[model samples]
Target: MKSPLAGLSKFDFFGVLLLRIGVGAVLAFHGYPILTGGGSVWTDVGKGAAIASLPPSFFEYAGLASGILQFIGGILLIIGMFTRGTALLLSIVVGFAIANLIAAGSFQLGFLAHLQMILALLGLVFIGPGRLSLDRKGI
Candidate 1:
């Protein structure tokens, strides 16, 4: 008796679903602190964008916005709602941050996570949400 899921060997959609769940959970966890961190946390997050040379207050607001995007976008990814659009926006944000880190000569071990995120986002953008997603069922 072969495995019950042996027939699913060719089922790539399950892979997409797993990817969405894994990445979505990570992003949601990542955003939770920043989202609830208030002014200080926002300030810290904004500092990453300081390369833009914007005003101090602008950094704080930008951080808050980043938190919201990650939190909300993560949820959308998990449920397969607005999957492509959400992943597209997240790709932009992740790409910018990764580029900045590389520019800053911070290519350390921690940088791998950002690299993985960008790749995953790109995959989602190109492959779509698949039939397991709400986007597919018109939900």
Candidate 2:
């Protein structure tokens, strides 16, 4: 005895699909430049905030990891495969970035971005990955 609204699974699938894709794509897009070493992406957060205390190696690895995760997570989110898991992981990474910024006394911009990321991650955690996801199909 499913409710009438329960039958509208397709809409739910695409809705969640778009959310995941959009978020992931943005993250990947933002991360790509820094990861490739074309230039520093953390000019505002890392350099502008705490260049004196931050090591070059730390910046290098952080850039690489952020780019890789966002790129991979974005693609997976678009395809609806491992949506929640990827979102969770990316969320954690975002958290780390925020933490870094805060530690560097760049709480102004970093705090805002961190809060936004937290919201996105929280949505994925509670939303169950939507109907269009691989997890859904497997179920």
Question: Judged by lDDT, which candidate is best?
Answer: 1
lDDT for 136 (candidate 1) = 95
Tens digits of per-residue lDDT for model 2, 56-130: 766655556676787787677767778778888888878777767677688696589777976886687778578
**Residue-wise lDDT of candidate 1 within 29-78, one digit each (tens)?**
88889899999999888778666667889889978888888898999999
- Per-candidate Cα RMSD to the true structure, in Å, reads 2.9, 4.7
Highest-scoring model, TM-score: 1
What pairs collide in candidate 2? none
- Model 1 clash pairs are none
Q: What is the C-alpha lDDT of each candidate?
A: 0.87, 0.70
lDDT of 1: 0.87
